[model samples]
Target: MEDLMQKATEATDDLYRIRDTYFPKDVNHKINTLQTHSQIALNILDSIPLEERKLATQRATYEYLRGKILDVFEEYSKKAEDHLSKAVKLNPSLADAWLCLGNCIWKKGDLPATRNCFTLALSKGPNKRILSQLSMLERRMAQGAENQEEIVAESIKHAKEAIALDVKDGNSWYNLGNACLTCFFVTGAWDHSKLQQSLKAYQNAEKDEGMKMNPDLYFNCATVNTYLENYERALSGFEAAALIDPCLNATEEVKKMINLVDKLDGLLKGQIKAKRLASLTSSLTEVQVKPSYKRATIDNLLDGLNKAIAVVGKVLFFIKHENITPLYYLVCDSNQICFVLTVYGMSNEAIKEGDQVTLLDPCFRNNNFSWNEKHYELRSIRVDFLEQVQVNGKPIPPRHSVRSSIYAQHKP
Candidate 1:
């Protein structure tokens, strides 16, 4: 009986190991291995003496191990739930069984019940793993709540608490980074400081060797870099994630970014819009910058603030994008150099193609990179408010400048 119990423990440990570390191209292999180990563990437990199994502690262990193996598959198994419930009833102090029960209930979409189980597990003791799971649960809950910001703040707090318990735990740092990234998007996706904090946490997570196995860390880190306009890092990070987990759409993201850059290059190189560009530039008149605002061009502009500067450009193409913030346009300056101009908090009717526009206090970036044997470069300038732009040499009317919509389209 002792030997059989030892074998059962070993099989259960194997299930946990595989559940934690296995990420395979073919999920069937993983599933098969888990099923095999689960059967072995169950058989060993069943072979134990009936007298020994009658003991409360022994019965709880048996039920918990069986339930956990089913839960390890991440599918909602009725048998798993029944066994876990029995285990917790047999021994109320079984924190791990409660954790397994919580996970099982989560799959059934009983989020509040799942939370109850997690809280019960935590009440038994402070477990870093349970705290991290609760943090994730908070973020998921925020998705539907009207007060999303408040809930995400709670998520960040729990993630921080987990890290405080085990500072060296890579998974906790990764969870913290995810929580911060969630905060960034939930609060309007305009906070650069939140993005920076997320990136820093992901960087710290990378210092731990175990985190390298988590493809989401790479994918999410790349997403933050993409928003920050660190294009090269974003590309590499996505590529790394794709290599690790082929199921992710990281490769598609790479292709989409490359395609956008290619389209920008085509529009800027005097291809489809050359005639319009020439005609617009011919009628362009000199516009004076305010004394406080200096004059600068795209090539000389730097990342971040090009503060107190004016850049004059003619709208050449209305850039199209899916529902995302900050409308985009391909524009050409008096020097005939083309760059993307992004406008936020302005209505679509506020500006039109061929309008001679002045950008005040512009934010800028010059992105250059090589991917998949192709080189790409793009220059961008951003105007955050209608007040920063003058159309056809005059400020826009307050009525037309109201932020009524946030979508982009292209029309000649």
Candidate 2:
């Protein structure tokens, strides 16, 4: 019976490890393997004499292993729930059984009950794995909630607690990074500090040798790098993720970045004639800024928070992306310097090509990278609020303001 129990435990661990790292192509084969392992465990448990398994501790162990195997299925299994509940009732000290019960309940969409299970599991003792699961649950709860920031902050807190338990645990660090990244998006993508913290967490996660098989780590780290305009790192990271999991969207992201670079390069080099450039550069005149606003140029921009300032430019052309917030456009300043301009908190109709716009408190990045032996350099600026952008010397109407959402990909 002891040897059978050991086999059950090893099978459960192996199933979890495979689930974490396997690619989508392995789904069918993976499910078959899960069933095979589960059947073996079930067979082992049933082979034990009823009298031999009469002890509560022994019976609870038997039920818990069987429950864990059923829980591995993608869909919620009532049988799994029943087995787990019996295990916990038989022996309340089985913390892992509670953990498995929580995971099973999560698939049923009973988030609050799942939380209760995790809380009970933690009450048994401090467990980093349980804490990490709780952290992920908090982040999922935050999605579309009115108190998104508060819940995501709690998620980050729990992730930190998990990390504190085992500083070298790659999975815990990965959870922390994901929580931080979610916070970065939840609070409005303007917070460079959050992105930096997330990147740092991912870097630490990568230090663990076991993390090498996780494609999501590279993909998420690349996402943060993309936001920070670390284009080279972003491309390389996405490439690494794609290599690990071809079914992931990481390859698409790499293609998009390369395509954007190509477009920006063409706009600057192919369209700018000497005569047209002279006419555009000569249209600039003295401009008025907001009462407290200071004037600055792209040449003096910084990475993070900049002084209240306005940099005026002419919208060369609109760069279109599907349903993405912060509309992209190519704009050139008086000196004929071109940069990608991103405006948030407004509809695309708020600005147009040939419009002279004032960018207030612009978030700036100097993006330079080489891909496929081709060199590309881009200066990018982002405006988070509608008020930060002035079209034709006037603020955009409030009717143009819309909550940011990304729902589809289509050409304008």
Clashing pairs in 1: none
What shift in Å separates residue 267 of candidate 2 from its native position after superposition? 1.8
Write model 2 residue lDDT over 1-412, tens digit each, in one string.
7876787788788777776677655568878877787777677667777887889999999899888888888899999999999999999989999999999999999999999999999999999999999999998887768887799899999999999999999989999999888876776555668879999999999999999989999999998887776879999999999988887888899988888778877775666786786687566556667788877777877975576877888888998753365578988887777888977556778899989898888878776678899988777887777778888889989887654142112100
Clashes of 2: 0
Which ranges in model 2 have alpha carbons more than 4 Å from their true place? 24-26, 44-47, 290-309, 344-350, 361-363, 385-388, 395-412
Evaluated against the true structure, the overall lDDT of model 1 is 0.80
Best by TM-score: 2
| TM per prediction | 0.85, 0.89
Residue-level lDDT tens digits of model 1 in 291-374: 898887777777878788888888977887543555679988876678888765566677899788999888897777776787
**After superposition, candidate 1 runs with Cα above 4 Å error:** 1-10, 270-278, 281-291, 321-327, 342-352, 355-357, 382-412
Predictions in order: lDDT: 0.80, 0.82
Give the top-scoring candidate (lDDT). 2
Clashes of each: 0, 0
